[model samples]
Target: MSDRKSSGGAFLIAAFAMIPLLPVASCVSEGHAGGAAAKATGTETTSQPTHATYSCGPRGTLTVDNFRTSVKLVDPEGESVDLPASPATQQSRYGETPYALVLDGKEALYMKSGKEPVTCNR
Candidate 1:
């Protein structure tokens, strides 16, 4: 019994760890008479990135809206900055100059022009 419980707990922990890596797929209906089963409901499936928030300690919080090809950052001042993926870099890096962001799974490295690089987590 104890062994079974440990296995179950391990599975739960692993599942939780994968939450950030999961892509959020949304299916939208055209509001037709049929609802995805009548063969004419007209459902469109779109994959959207999860909106993640990261705490940057004293620098304040950042809300991220990742769009696969690009990422939008909401700064502490409620300003939104959109950054396209850097094709030059192999990693999932974005932006340049005044703002640069590098994301690795659930953790992110944010760098600004005059400040030190800050590590952020969701």
Candidate 2:
């Protein structure tokens, strides 16, 4: 009787262990629908866009709409631009020609063509 109880407990433990693998297995078998975009931009988006207004002190406030693969940036003067995700060794970065935004937690460093980099906080 004790042997049967141990076998049942082992089965139960194995069943619980497999639960965490279910989502990963489903994704593997079904494949990701946005896999191509994800690979191109190197961003896996699982939530909605985050909108924030960052205070840059002397440089003024910057309105940022951060998306999965792109970031829409509005300068203090109200000029707006959309930047795509760029590769970074650490921290999140988005760039488009004369504009680049690097986000580190609640702070962001904005760089443009003819201006100095501006540091802003959320």
Top candidate (TM-score): 2
Candidate 1 C-alpha error for residue 116, in Å = 2.2
lDDT of 2 at 99: 75
Candidate with best lDDT: 2
lDDT of 2 by residue, 1-122 (tens): 99986775565455344434433444453255556645534542322238878898877999889774788989866789998766422126677676777666577677776665667788
Residue pairs whose backbone atoms clash in candidate 1: none
lDDT of each: 0.60, 0.65
Clash count, one per candidate:
0, 0
> What is the model-wide C-alpha lDDT for candidate 1?
0.60
The local lDDT score (0 to 100) that residue 8 gets in candidate 1 is 55
Model 1: which ten-residue window has the lowest total lDDT? 40-49
Q: Given candidate 1, what's the lDDT at residue 92?
A: 49
Please provide, for model 1 over 48-105, each residue's C-alpha lDDT reduced to its tens digit, 9 standing for 90 to 100: 2358898877778888887756789887656789876654321346664576676766
